[model samples]
Target: MRRPRSAVWLALRRNPVFYVAGLLVAVLIVMAAAPGLFTDADPSRCRLGLSREGPAEGAPFGYNLQGCDLYARTVYGARASVVVGVCATAAVVLLGGMIGMTAGYFGGWVDAVLSRVTDVFFGVPLLLGALVVLVAFPSGAAASPWETTAKVVLALAVLGWTTAARIMRAAVIQVKNTDYVNAALSLGSGHGRILTRHVLPNAVAPVLAWATIAVGTFIAVEATLSFVGIGLQPPVISWGTEISDAQAYVRQSPHMLVFPSAFLSVTVLAFVMLGDAVRTAMDPRERRA
Candidate 1:
């Protein structure tokens, strides 16, 4: 028989998609963490005199209509996008895990009530619901951008978690009655112990996969909000704000729109691809392959 692939290499070896996605994601994390590694120019300082300049020596992405270094702005914009995406994803995982795990493990009326509530949330479209929530707290000044970011994060987290909750519930339900669970119950383990120690650990893997996908999803949602001039206002460097700024100048300066949009697309695609790879890794059929 052929030598078995090691666990670390299995995903990448069987599916090159993981390797490509992982590489792109690593570059983005680096870009988000240390933007200066990419450029030293200031994103905000603009010179209208050099409006829409094409790629040159120092500025590979060239100048925007306002004459700011497009490359620097794009690089700096990564931090804000990544932060919102990550924070929102964390909130989704926390809220969804609790509700989903509890309802799934307990069953009976608890499951019925939680499932019903999830359905109510499910009926509301995510983007629409998040818009309603964010509209309540509009951004006013540069000094309070965090306030807008926070509310946007809150809205996305609250509305986006239902899917995760449903996924976890399904996973928990699948694992709740497994032999290991029965073994724990027979050993007289308390409900909490069985849940935290046995049930949650096993059921939560699928949630991790969902969360990887959610990070990209929430980022896109933030961008959508910013595109509409609601999420991240002026003075906040975000890919969404950049896109909104460049949208009107499409005919005049397509590069302005292209660069940021490209970055945003790649980031989102990276997360989604990573999520797919994770999901595949967890599948028993894939393992046997």
Candidate 2:
């Protein structure tokens, strides 16, 4: 069932899921990059009288219980959410890839020890572990926005890298004995050069795909943490905080819950879909199946 490279590319183009997922992701990145292009209204501008106001002339998303324009808040919140997801994913990939690639390429005690460590870390739940770690950075006294962002990234990365490590390890093992790798090894190439020139380039595709999917998961986790009052706080308008603030008033103004929830879902779903598309495109097994 293996098709020509051109055929595979053509198939991907014909796949509706690819375009839909890619388009949605593109829109989100745009929103996150420059909310001004989409909406000029200040998200923080609020009025007591405007509280709970229904959709008006320009406010398609209506006003929140705080009388803030829901549309603007949602627009601005994308930046925080996207920023955290991207940053966290990059950290996870770097840490995970390094651990995995080394363990995979150099088997023996190193592999055994790293693998055991990975298992121990993997057994701990991401959310629970992150919450435990984040608890130390209490919201009281208000940690700086950058400091809070770093804490969340570190918490997630600590646990997140295990899977990435496993993937990288597996990939490296699969590629380490390939002809090119052997040739490089025979040429007196140093460990670093052999690894950089041969192993990683070949083994990194799958991990990249998985990391792409994990971005959505990371974003969702950030929202969950914020909802629980730990991740990002006031002065930093994230979708999670907005959702958390709106939950109490859900019954009165369902849009409060609906708007942020919708945005979060769409963002997460888009990334998941993009990941799926990338995996399918790159992984021949999926296409064969």
Candidate 3:
């Protein structure tokens, strides 16, 4: 059953988890959008004199091995990481949703072919596939930040979309046979009109929930790839890159590892909690439970 807007809002409001997770996600967005609001210090400006220094007067988070302000770098790091997560999630949802909807609605051999392809892609692990793709088309030292980010996003989307496609395919199969859909067909509605106006709105809730969680998943994956030195390279200054830089200095400067890792963990957790909140609110059974 479709929930009324007011009821949905009420349900979200009633969940304390929703508020906490929403606040974290909101802060992350602000940090990504305007790091200067948090600190005026330059993220890129490095001072070799301050290398590996602990917290000081102006630099609360101190400096890293590269002598860049850890506070500033951590603040600015949100931009690239969030960009990769959001962009990759959008691509995966769009591509997977389209394929799933088409296959589910058209059925027959179309469904069989797409399902087989999805299974094959699903069989490949996300990280392994991404690693292979990244290695196959290495981003040279001269590649721009945007180019590097795009390659990571593309790799993630290609490998990670199977789950979304499968979810959407199942949802569409259940939805297309519903009374509203059948009624629309009997009322002389065109296939496109019925699909766009009726089917998609009803079918998208599950996908929305999955995409929410996938944002965090992709962010973590990006960080892992960067940590392994095949993901986002330097000059991009993602949380992953910072974490990678901190690997060798774990004992000497634990702050470097702790700060970025904490931020990444919290961000990922927030998304996951938000996804749980969404899922609970949308599903009457979960809400009742």
TM-score winner? 3
Cα lDDT tens digits for candidate 2, 191-275: 9998898888889988998988999999999999999988888878899998898888888888888989999999999999988
lDDT of 1 by residue, 1-289 (tens): 4333355256556788888988988999899899989889999899998788888898999888789999999999998889899999999899989999989989999999999999999899988998887778665555476777788888888888888899899999999889999998999999999988988888888899889898899999999998998787767789998898888889888888999999999999999999889888777677668
lDDT of candidate 2 at residue 103, scale 0 to 100? 96
In model 1, what lDDT does residue 267 have? 97
Residue 56 C-alpha lDDT in model 3? 86
Task: Report backbone clashes per prediction.
Answer: 0, 0, 0
Clashing pairs in 2: none
Error of 3 at 159 (Å): 0.8
* Candidate numbers, best TM-score first, in rank order: 3, 2, 1
RMSDs, each prediction? 2.4, 2.1, 1.4
Model 1 quality (TM-score): 0.93
Best by lDDT, which number?
A: 3
Taken over the whole model, the C-alpha lDDT of each candidate is: 0.87, 0.89, 0.92
C-alpha RMSD of candidate 2:
2.1
Q: Which stretches of candidate 3 lie over 4 Å from their true place?
A: 1-4
